[model samples]
Target: MSVHDLWDGLPKAEIARRRQKNAVRWQRRWRGPDINPTTGRLAQHKQSYSDNQKPQALLDEAAQIQSPHQQGTRSSSVTVGTLLDRHLAAKADRAPKTIEADEYHASVVRDTFGDRVLSTIDATEIEIWSQRAEPAASSRKKQLELLRAAIKRGVRDNLVGVDVTEGLVVSLRHTERPYWSSQELRAVVDAASSDFDATMFRVLGFLGLRENEMRTLRVGDLVGNQLTVRDSKTRAGIRTLPVPASVLPSLVELAGSRPKADWLFVSPRRPGNAVSKGYANAALTRAVGGANAIRIDPIRRLSAHGLRHTFAAIALSEAGGNLLSVSRALGHARPSITLDRYGHLAPAGLEPLMALVDAFAVPKAA
Candidate 1:
């Protein structure tokens, strides 16, 4: 038989099946209550792609455009905006600063694809969006993480089909954390415009409290030589630290007879409020300016947080490389976190390394 006549041996149904298998390719069937393209009503959706189209990609696109919601379900479709709103509402109990951060990060997502159907968001779309995001790499990474967390919660709540942010990664450029040297710190303290400014410097450099923590300090928090951290960024940060003798007298004198609830570092501009971050920065700048004017060894301008780091560095060096002590004093959640940032600065000795080997050493055969 001729090539054309060979098909005549088979039934018409088989011939049609072979033609379908060879001539026309169908994308994987996506069964969902999508809007029918032919009839703008909720029905089973079907679509075909050209030879140049990827079956998987076409299927994904169809799914996103068609059935973002469940079939026959009376629930409203969820969007990125809805997810972020829900996420924010759920975090009503978090600290105000934490909530503010969440909102800031959430705004980036909201501004980009907030109205987009949450179910339609895929990893590829997010990755592309992240690349175009205007925030610095670190800030953008935080924003991405916030969006991922919201989507993850949506999935757990059955509001989303999948977590599209599963494997997304944002690379951050590492920069050295600036800190003040001991001599620089002492010069800044000596050059302080007022006794209170000098005391603030001492508190930050000796206590290792964060700038905010220092600003929020209260007289009642200090008891003899013990200082209590009542409020902090994390629960681990709420710790009591032994007051260094060097700063004790200054703190006691600063406390005077102020009420327990009164702020230790009251705002210079706003009397009722705690010291502003701007004031902290300006104080450091002024002190550095004074130190540079007369000193042979000029001081580098540093932020208030740099004093906290200086405290960590000093503690690690003076405490015989006691990582635990430094970590606890700095209110780090874990010793590993402390080690990651300052481990190299720890005093190195063969004795500590040899001790580890000695612990596992076997007695020589007698």
Candidate 2:
């Protein structure tokens, strides 16, 4: 007898076991409204996802799967968009900045894999996702991170059989590091038509202050030709960065208002509110050409933080890679962050310090 007949003859408990197996193995099929199979007319399916989903999209995915001619097994899937939505839901409890980053990553994933399904995705898909857009290395990294995070969620949900993203990493072959040339810095400073922006650019480019530190600098903190900045990223960012006499004049202008303990970068929107990073950036662009205002290494463009990188590079390269000292000046929580980032600036590190002994050893010929 056929299995259907045999099942009919089975005991109640056995029948329950068979039904349970079927449900567990059930793969939904998508059959859109019938058309003249000959006419090829397209039809729309109904909406889906309790609040942020669509059933028609899910149903349409089911339509593409075909059972093996000689077997009953089938492949299943969940959509990229669906997975992204779940990630978005996860951000509800995360920090504001973290939520922002996750959203941006989700935006990239949706743009790249809007129609791809989770079951069909693989390392190849991730590789393409990283390169197909061919933007910046940092952007690609964010996209890859988002995909990996979603795949991790899949593993947690039992939606996919394996963590296909196990060893995947964003390609760093063309990753551009951010640094600014002295001439470019001058060009932006000279180009500054607005007092506020010109002053901001000089502070960032010369002093190497981040958006937060730039916004926080004050008149009282300026003493003995050094500016003390309080770091908010960690308690350790509190630091003193001595200024080149050239940067002093601009610091004077920024602190002229003698604004309260309030942020120097404070937004005009509210007298006391922190100045918007966007406004400072926009002003910078206005003062300098868009390209000049943004930092770019030899080949790529970088944002405000690039100015910070440029400063670090200049300091380390000039000082022969004094990281312990640079970390203190840059207000980093730990010296390790400095080493990881600018260790290469210390090309001298490649040659063992013991190599220095060769120079010091009595110059026998002299």
Q: Which predicted model would earn the best lDDT?
A: 1
Tell me each candidate's TM-score.
Answer: 0.58, 0.45
Tens-place lDDT per residue, model 1, 1-366, is: 001123447787987886777644343344446676777776653443323223443333334445646432312356777677666656757767777888788887889878888666678989988776477876777788889888887777666778888898776655567777677788889999889899999989988899888988988998889999877876678999999898999999988899988898888778877888778789888988998999887777788888888887777765554888899999986686687677766879889778889978968879
* Candidate 2, lDDT over the whole model: 0.64
Q: Which candidate is the best by TM-score?
A: 1
lDDT of 1: 0.75
Q: Report the C-alpha lDDT of model 2 over 1-366, residue by residue, as the tens digit.
A: 001133536688887887776533222233346664665774433322222243343333233333334122212456677666655665566556656777787877888676787667777767766776467776787677777777677567655556666787665543346786666666666776666677777677777778778776655787667778875565557677788888777767667767446465556677777667677666655655644545464223447777777777777775464788877767776686677577677557536566777678767785
lDDT of 2 at 249: 77
> Against the unseen true structure, what C-alpha lDDT does each candidate score?
0.75, 0.64
